[model samples]
Target: MAGIYIFSDRADIAAEIVGFARAAGKEAFVMALGEEAAQALTNAGADKIYAIDGDSELIESYAKDIAEFLIKAGAELFAVGATPRGRDLAARVAGYLDCAMASDVVSVEYHDNQLTCVRMLYGGAVQEKQVLSGLSVVTIPAGKFEPAQGESTIEALKLKADTRVSIVETAPIVKEGVDLSKAEKVVCVGMALDKEEDLQIARDLAAVLGAELGCTRSIAEERHWLPVESYIGISGAVIKPRLYISMGVSGQIQHVYGIRDANLIVAIDINEKAPIFKAADYGIVGDLYEVVPLLTEALKK
Candidate 1:
C-alpha cells in the first residue's frame, strides 16, 4: 500500500493533518523540518518522522526541492495547511510534481486508493466535492479538524537545497489586538450603528468577552471606525470563529458569506425582519444600544 504523508511548517496544523489521517484509517508519516516540529508530530500521532538536517531557511524559501523529494519518495498523498503561504507552496509543489491538487479542504476521505475532498467554491457560497486519481496534494483548512495523538519514530533525511527566494529582512505589521481570522470569539458591528461613538459598546463588549472586534465594509471603509484589517465581508477577512456575535449587522449576502463558517452566530438588531436573522443560530429583536451594555455587564458578572 502507498503511504500517506502529511507536511507543514506549522506544528498545530500538522497535528490536524494527522487527525485527518487517523479518521480515514490510515497511518500518518510526517516530513518535519526541525527537531521541535518532529517532536510535535511524534506527540500528535505521526507514525514515522523524516527530519531534514540542514539549513531550514532553504526549505521555507523554496518548494521545488520539497516537491522533488515527495515525488521521489513515492508519496501517495501529501497534505499541508491551507494558509496563504501554504497555499502558494502547495500550488508550486503540485505544478512541479504534475499531480492533482485541492485547496481549503475541510473534509477528506481516502477510499479505493483515491482521495476525495470537500471544499468551498465561488467565495464560500457553494461546496464542491472532488476525487483525485494517482498521487495528489491537498491543503487542509486550519482549525477545521481536531488533532490526533500518538508516538512516532524519527529518521533523518538529506537536504536538497534549491533556494530561489532570498529573504530581505522580515518586517511585522504594526497592528494591535487579536487576528480576527483565528479568533475563537468575535464581536462585529455594522451600519446599524448610529454614530462613531456608538462603537464603544462593541469595544466594551469585546473586552468583556475577550473577543476580537470586527465591523462591516461600510464601518471600516466608509466611516473608518475600525482598521481595514478588522473588517469582515466579501472584500474583507473570512473568519470561522466559534462564537460570532454581530450587533447591528444587516447581513448582506457578501457580509454573511464571510461569517458562514462560524460555529455559532448570535445577531442583535432592532429591525425584526433583518436578513441577518435568517443566518443567525440565535437572534434578538431589540435595540443594540440598550442591549450591548446589559450583555457586557452580564458577561462580566
Candidate 2:
C-alpha cells in the first residue's frame, strides 16, 4: 500500500511535499515525469519514486494513467502542488479516484486512520478544518514546508499517453522578481505611492536591510509599477518572513494575510489610522517619502 503519493513537474515543489509527508508521519512516494525528475526528487529525500520514464509532448498527457495506477496500488493520500498544471492533474485524478479533495491546503495531519486538513477561506478571512475518510487528494501551494532529503528506490511505470492534445508552441513569460514565498525579509510597497519613481525609497530601504522588494495588489496590477509576481496577499504570494516592512500600505485584510506570519512587522504611512498599523509590530505615522530615507540611513550606521 502506498503511504502518501506526491506529484509535481518541478522537483523542488515535489521535495516540499516530501517534507510535508514526512512531517505528517508517512513515507513519501512521488511521481516523476522522466528519469531526471525521479532521481532529483529521490536525491531531495523522497522515499519512493514512481518513475514514468518517457518523452512526451506534455507531462499532463499521462494523468489518466497515473490516476488509475495509484487507485490500483491502494494509494492513501495524493498530495499535489497548486501550480496551473498541477491543479489540472489533481482534479482529473480526484475525479477518477472518486475521492474528496482539498485545494490550497496549508496544513494537514494524519493520525489513527484520520486525515485532518486545514485551508483558508474567503481570502484568508476564515480557516476551515475538514476531516476526510480514506483515499483522499489535496493540493498545496509552495513555501508551506521546508524541503526534506532522503534515499529512495525507483519503481518504473509505463502509462498510455493522451493522443488528443498536442502542443503547438511554447513561450515562457519573462518575469523580474524573486520568489517572495522563500524570502526571509521583505519590504513591500502599496498604493500609498503616488508614482513609480517613488518606489526608489522602498528599494533603498530593502537594499539596506538585505530584503527582497514586494508590493500590494494595486502596486502590481493597477499601477503596473511591479510585476504580479511581486504582489503579496491572499490572491498573490503568501510569505512568512523573519522581518517584514511595509511602506505606504493601507493594510487591507487581504494584504495582511500574506505577511501575518512574519516574525516582526513594521509599517510606515502618513495616516495614523492606516489599517496596516493595526497589523504591524511597529507603526510609524509619517510620510514615507521622508521616513524611509532616514530609516535607511539609520540602519546603515
Candidate 3:
C-alpha cells in the first residue's frame, strides 16, 4: 500500500482525508501547522501529527521549515488544501522535491498502488483524470468532500528542520467590507459593464442586497477595475454561494467554473445567445446600466 500524507489547517478536513486514505488502504499521516489544527487532525484519525507554531507575519519562513519535515517524512502522495497558503506551501515543497503538482483536485482514488486524481477542467464542463506516475503533490479544493467523525489519537512528532528565509517586517493590506468567499450572496460584474463608472452601479446593487462584489478576469485584470484576487474563474476562486448574480458576464468556460456550484444563478446580458444564460437559473436579456440601478432601488425599497 502507498503512504499518504495530508497537510491541513482544519482538523475536520484533515480527518476526511484520512478517511479517504484508509478506505483506499493507504497509511495516512496528517500534519497540522498549529496546536488547534494538530488536535483536530488527531481526532480525525491521523496516525501522526506534526505541530508547528510561528507568527503569521513570517509564513513563508515557517512553511519552508515545515516543508523540510514533510520531505523527511517520506510521503509518496502528498495532499494539501487548495487555499492560498496551501498552494504556496505545495509549490515550495514540490519545487524542493522536484515533483509534479496538481491544484484544485476534487477527488482521488488508489488502484494497484497508483494514485489517480480527478479535477474539473473547462469550467466544470469536463472531469480530467490524471494518474500520477511518480511522487506527486495535490491540492484539493474545499467542500469537495464530506468530513468524517473519528476517535482522537494524536501522536506528536518533533521536527528538527530549519528555514533558510527569515522575516524582517510585515504590513497587512486590510480591505473594509465583507470577504466575497464568506458572502452568502455575491454580485459578479463582467466585461460587458462597458464603462468603469458602471462598477459603482453594481456596487450599489451589492450594497442594497448586502452582498459582496466580484468580477470576471477581464474586468479584474485587463481593465484593472477590481483586484486580481477578486477575479473568479477556473484559475481563480471557486465559489459555492446561495445566490450568484452575474451582470454582463458572457460566461466564458473559464469564468463559469467559479460559480457552477451556486444554488441560484441570475444572469443579465443584452445578448440572449450569451453562454451564461444557458447555465443560469434565470436570465434577463437587456442593458445592465438600466436594469442594475432599477434592481438596486427595488431591493432597497
Candidate 4:
C-alpha cells in the first residue's frame, strides 16, 4: 500500500486529501505547521498527524525540520498545495530527498504499483500525464480536489531533529490596501489600454468596485505602469478570484494561465478576435478608452 502525505495549512484541504487516500485504500498522514492546523487535519480524517513545533519566526528552519521528518518517515508520495509557501517547502523537501518533483498537478492515481500524476501546462492549454518514479513529491493546485470526510481515527506523532540553522532577523513589508492574492475581485488591464492616461480609467473602476488592480506583463514590465509583482501571467502570479475583469487584454495563452480559476471573467477588447473572448464569460467588443471610463462612472454611481 502507498503512503500519502497531505501538506497544508487549512484543515479543509487536508480533509479532502484524506478522503482521496481513503478512497484509494492507502494509509494517509497529515503534516501541518501549527497545533490548530494539525487538529483540523485530524478532524478531516487523517490517520496520523505530525505537527512541527517551533517559533513561527523561523519558517525556513521549521521547513527543513519537517522535510527531514517526512523523508525519514518513508512517505511514498508527498503532496502539498501549490501556494507560495507550499511550493517552496515542497521544493526544499524534494531536493533534500533527492527525488523528482512536479508542480501544479490537478489529479493523481495509483495503479499497478505506479503513481500517475496529471498536471496542467502552458497556461492550461494542455494536460500532461506523468508516471513518477521512486519517491515522488507533488504540488497540487488549490481548488482542484475535494476534501476528505467521514469518521476516522487520528494519532499525533512527535519527531526529534537537530536545528542546523537559526533565524537572525525578521521584518514585515508594509503596504497599503489588500494583497492581490486575497482580493475577492480583481481588475486586470492589458497592452490594449493604448495610452498611459487610459490606465486611470481602469484604476478608477477598481477603486469604485473595491477591487485590486492587476496587469499583463507588457503593461507592468515594459511600460512600468504597475509593479512587476502585480503582473498576472504564466511567469507571474496565479490568481483565483470571485470576479476577474479584463480590460483590453488579448487573452494570450500565457496571461490566461493565471486567471483560469476566476469564477467570472469579463473581457473588454475592441478586437472581437482576441483570444481572451473565448475564455471570457462576458465579452464586450469596444474601445477600452471609451468603455473603461463608462464602466468607472457606472460603478461609481
Candidate 5:
C-alpha cells in the first residue's frame, strides 16, 4: 500500500521525480522504456526497475500494461511526468483504474499517512490543494525535483502495448535554446521595446549578467522575434531561477505564474503601476531603453 510507481517516456524525467518517492519513504519503482532508458535511469535511486521488454517506441501503447500492474501491485500512488506522452498515458490509466488524478502538480506532501498535492488552477490564478485517499496518479512538471545517483535492480516485462493505433512516421522536432527552468539567472524581454532591433539592449544585459535570455509570449508567439521555446507564460516555459529579471514585461497573471517560483523577481517597466511591479521582489520604474543599458554597465563593473 505504500509502494510508488513512477513512469515517464523520458528517462531523465522518471529519474527527477524519484526524489518525491524517496521523500515519501516508499518503495520507488521506475518504468524505463528500453535498455538505453534503463541505463540512463540506473542513477535514479529506484528500489526496482520495471522496463518494457522491447523498444516499443510508442509509450502510449502500454497504457493497459501500466494500469494493470498498479492494480495488481496495489500501488498507493502513480507518479508520472507531465509531458504530452506522459499526460496521455496517465489519463488512460486513470480511466482504467477509475482513480483520482492530479495534473501539473508542483508540490506534494505525504503527511499523517495521506498524500496531498498542490497544483495550479484557472490558468495559474489559484493553487488547488488535493488529498489523495485511494490509489491516485499525479503528473509533475520538470525542475520540481532533483534526482540522486544510486544503484538499482532492473526487471523486464513483456510488452503489452495497445495496437489499435499505428505510428506511420516519426520525426524529431528541433529546438535550440537554453533550458530556462535550470537557469540560475534569467534576463527576460517583454513587449515594451519599440522594435526587434532593440533586443540588443536586453541581450547586452543578459551578456553582462551571464544569464539565460527569456521573453514574454508575444515576443515569441506573435512577433516571432525569438523561438517558441524562449517564451515564458501560462502556456510557455515555467522557470524557477535564483534571479529572474523581467524587462518591460507587463506582468499578466499568466506571465507571473511562470516566474512565481523564482527566488528573486525583479521587474523594470516604464509605468510605475504596471502589474509586474506588484509581483516583483524589486521594481524599477523607467523606460527599459534607458534603464537596461545603465544596468548592464553596472553589472560589468
Candidate 6:
C-alpha cells in the first residue's frame, strides 16, 4: 500500500503533518534530520520515524538525495511545511521525481488513491482546489491543521553520499528582538504614520501588549521605517499571531494575505471604508495618532 511521507526540518511541524496523514487514515511517516528527531516525531503522531543523522546544513544540501529516497520508498504523498526553505526543497524534490506538486496547501484530503488540496492563489484573494494525478508532493501551511499526536516506530537512515554544497560554518541571524513567526501577538502598521516620529506610538503599543512590532512592505521596504524582517506579506514573513492589531494599513491583498490565520484582527484606521475593516474582528474609525496612545494607556491600567 502507498503510504504518506512528511519531511520537516522542524519536528513540531512534522508531527503536525503526521497528524494529517493519520486523519486521512493512512500510515504516517516522518523523515527527521537530527539526533532527537525520532523521539520527537513519535510523540507528535508519526507511525514511523526515519531519522537521518545530519545537521540542518547537511540535510538542506541533501534535498535532492532525500527526494530519491522517497521515490524508492514509494511514498504516494509527500508533504512539507510551507515555509520558504520547505517550499524550495519540495519543488526540487518534485523536479527530481518528475511528479505533480502543490505549494502552500491549506488543506489536504485523500481520495481514490490520490490527494486533493486547497491552496491560496493570486496573493491569497482566492482559494483553489487542486487534485494531483500521481506521486503527489505538497507544502502544508502552518496553523491550517493542528499538530498530530501519537507514538511512532523509530528507524535510522544514513546518507552514504555527499552534495556539492557543504556548510563549513554556521551562524544564526542575530536579531535584536523576538522572532515574528513565533510571536503570538503582533502590532503592525501601514502608511498612516506621517513621519518617523510616529513609530514610537506603535512601538509603545507593542510594548504594552508584549507583542512584536510588524509593518507592511511599504513601511519596511519603501519608507524604511522598519527593517525588512519586520515586513509581513507574500514576499515577506507569514504570521499566525493570536491578536493582530493594525494601524494605518489600507488592507491590500498582499498585506492581508500574511495575517489570514490570525485569530483576532483589530484594525485602527482613519478611513472607515478601508478594506481592512472587512477583514478585522474589531475596528476603530479614527486617527491612529489619537487612538493608539489611548489604547496603550488603557492596556497599561
True-vs-predicted CA distance for residue 25, candidate 4, Å: 2.3
Off by over 4 Å in 1: 53-60, 179-185, 204-212, 221-223, 233-243, 261-264, 269-274, 284-301
lDDT tens digits, residues 21-55, model 5?
88777889888777677777887899888778743
User: How high is each candidate's TM-score?
Assistant: 0.80, 0.85, 0.77, 0.76, 0.87, 0.84
Per-residue error (Å), model 5, residue 35? 3.7
Which pairs clash in model 1? none
Whole-model lDDT, candidate 3? Answer: 0.76
Better-scoring candidate (lDDT), 1 or 4: 1
TM value for model 3: 0.77
TM-score of model 1 vs. true structure: 0.80
lDDT of 1: 0.83
Q: Which candidate order results from sorting by TM-score in descending order?
A: 5, 2, 6, 1, 3, 4
How many backbone clashes does every candidate have?
0, 2, 0, 4, 0, 1
For candidate 1, write residues 131-182 as lDDT tens digits. 9988889988777678987788888877765565667787997875457889
**Model 2 lDDT per residue over 21-42, tens place:** 8888887888888777777776
lDDT of each: 0.83, 0.87, 0.76, 0.78, 0.86, 0.83
Worst 10 residues of 4 by lDDT: 153-162
lDDT tens per residue, model 6, 129-155: 988987879998766667887666888
Global CA lDDT of candidate 2, please? Answer: 0.87
- Residue 79 lDDT, candidate 6, scale 0-100: 88
Give per-residue CA lDDT, model 4, range 17-40, as digits (tens).
676677778888877765666665
lDDT by residue for model 3 (26-126), tens: 77777766676676565666566666565453333454555566566666877787767777777777887778777778787777877788887766889
Distance from true location, Cα of 90 in model 4, Å? 2.3
